[model samples]
Target: MSFPDEILIAGSGPAGLTTALSLHEAGFKVRVFEAVPEIKPLGVGLNLLPHAVRELDELGLLAPLAAAGVACHELAYFTKRGERIWGEPRGLAAGYQWPQISLYRGALQFTLLNAVKTRIGADRLHLGRQLTGFDATPGHGVRARFLNRATGHEETADGRLLIACDGIHSAARKIFYPTEGPPRWNGAVMWRGVAECDPVLDGHTMIMAGHTRVKFVCYPISSQATRPGAQQLNFIAELRYDTTELSEREDWSRAGNLADFLPQFESFRFPWLDAPAMIRAAPAVWVYPMVDRDPLPRWTHGPVTLLGDAAHAMYPIGSNGASQGILDARVLTGCLRHHRADPEAGLTRYDAIRRPATTQIILSNRQQGPEACMQLVEDRAPNGFQKLDDVVSRAELDAIAAKYKQLAGFAIQELNTRPSLASPTA
Candidate 1:
């Protein structure tokens, strides 16, 4: 069994596409498969953290991304009562070499898709090819089977490696661990929607609101919409609930009724933004359990492996869900580039570096994610705080915030001081 230079990637989302583009740039022949008949703009907002930005920057994509996205400068935490709890600089303002971006998920995906097409050619992407199964060929490559969505006919493809970026509920992951069960819900049901609203706060600030029982967060994803003063703002309404049922673990397009959970936000009227009005005016709403799997011990099996959500789907609490996936693509590409002589060694190295890093984030997101600052302030003053200083000291809040930055592996100082991934071991 000999390793080939070509790889077959399962999934057309950010992780798979990014991996394909990067690997192509590294001199690897890449092919990508998507389960959908046609790729449509699904899902809502996602943040492009600095770490991810660095990867895109290296790929010469920063300008195109900046043209299509909004650069966020700060993230603010406030109580439902409209009191500012904590605020920190974001993106380049936070001293990172790269800036942070917030945009519609579809816009980002399309941007990456376009880039991949430009670099690797449109023929590289195969739509309507749902990855069904795969097997390692003795010691070196993977033979993958797929069900064509349009023809309903079977197809087979072979490559030196198979990557499952198929996302959460990944068919590739299921093939590996069939009995692992559905993604474990974190006891928090979240409803998301985009609102056409005027600038809130600094307009670029991402805000976290409410407490554990009735927490909500919103931020402006775009400033230029059809009407003036109407920005495309994204909001997420989360509440604690039992998650034993696995009936609603559908894809991102699952529709949610406003009445199902609007009662909690009925009274949530803040001076900066009217919560109920925004929710009501939204033309579309998506609902999903704020859930993630406990980190896996490893993501590699022979020539087949996992990447992105298929690898480590974590709570979106820290705004690292998509960014982490992009990071995985970059690191995996780095490994593959360095060890092309033995591609299997590259897969093993990718696992060694990223599995532990992402595993730490998965567990941290469950325990004390970036939202911990808001949680601490809310817990101290449930009703209302007479004074911000009395409710929680600035030092305490800063420490909590800094800890999350470190854990998420994007602390500006740490990244600057540490050696790059190319320098043997980082």
Candidate 2:
């Protein structure tokens, strides 16, 4: 088969947009198809680890991203009783060349979308095109079929390569893994919201309290909440319920009621911050099950492949989901650059390099990832702790943190020394 010219990208989320940007920068023609008719600043906050931030920096997006979100300074873990379990400097504070960022998921998407349009041109992006299916033409490229959600029209486009970044419910993924059902639920439900509140700690610290069964995570996503001494805080209150089955649809925008989970944190007031107050002050709360899919043995088939959540959906335990997807975009682009003469070879190399790397993260997240520190403290000292060392040693905590960083491909020294994933020409 002969190498074709343009690449077809499905979904306009972070993964797809980043992939489009990277390929376009490498002097490749690319087009992105998004299911949403229009992009909006929707969804809550997300973290971009230092490694992921490095990729964004190479794309010349660091300035806009820093403007949209807070550069996190520290990550601390605490118990339900409001006692600190572990604390460590993060991002630049941790000596990384890049800083870890906390920003709204929608803001990140829109930023990437704008970058794509500015670089690749607006005509290359096809909105309201919901991917229904795709086919690989024998001696030609892949033919992707889409349903125009706006006009009820069917459309078909052909590309040399088809990259699926359509997210968890990706139609392309379904076609590949036909037997796979809905995402596997881990019996936990998460209620997320953002509130304008006084800065807790340093105003740039990310905190995770409680254990696996019941937990609370809070951090500021933006600096827009300038009410004298207040900042915009994004938070998630998660609880593992009795039923293992997912009762409601897995929608990110599903409305949630405070009455259901408020009692659990009724007495969770602390000197620095009030968990209950933050939860109540939010304009709205969205509920979603903490779910992920079993890592697939393969992510490539001929010239078609998957990326981001479509390829590897892991629990949001360690803030690695979006970061991993960003890394996917970078590595895949580099592979394509190396194997441009043979698109199939590029797809295969991308799969070989990313599949195993993300599979480990998927399994690690299932074991709670770095959040294991919180659970360990909870298990060792269910009531409370006089001194953290008395319950768990410093060495144990250090080991947990180090292992996770290494597994997530963000070990401080390693990340600093690693070469950029950008194509040589780029």
- Give me the runs in candidate 2 sitting further than 4 Å from their true place: 1-4, 424-426
lDDT of 2 by residue, 362-423 (tens): 99999999999999999999989788889999999999999999989999999999887766
In candidate 2, how many Å is residue 349 off?
A: 0.6
Residue 229 lDDT in candidate 1: 70
Model 1 residue 47 CA deviation (Å) reads 0.6
- What are the clashing pairs of model 2? none
Best by lDDT: 2
Identify the leading candidate in terms of TM-score.
2
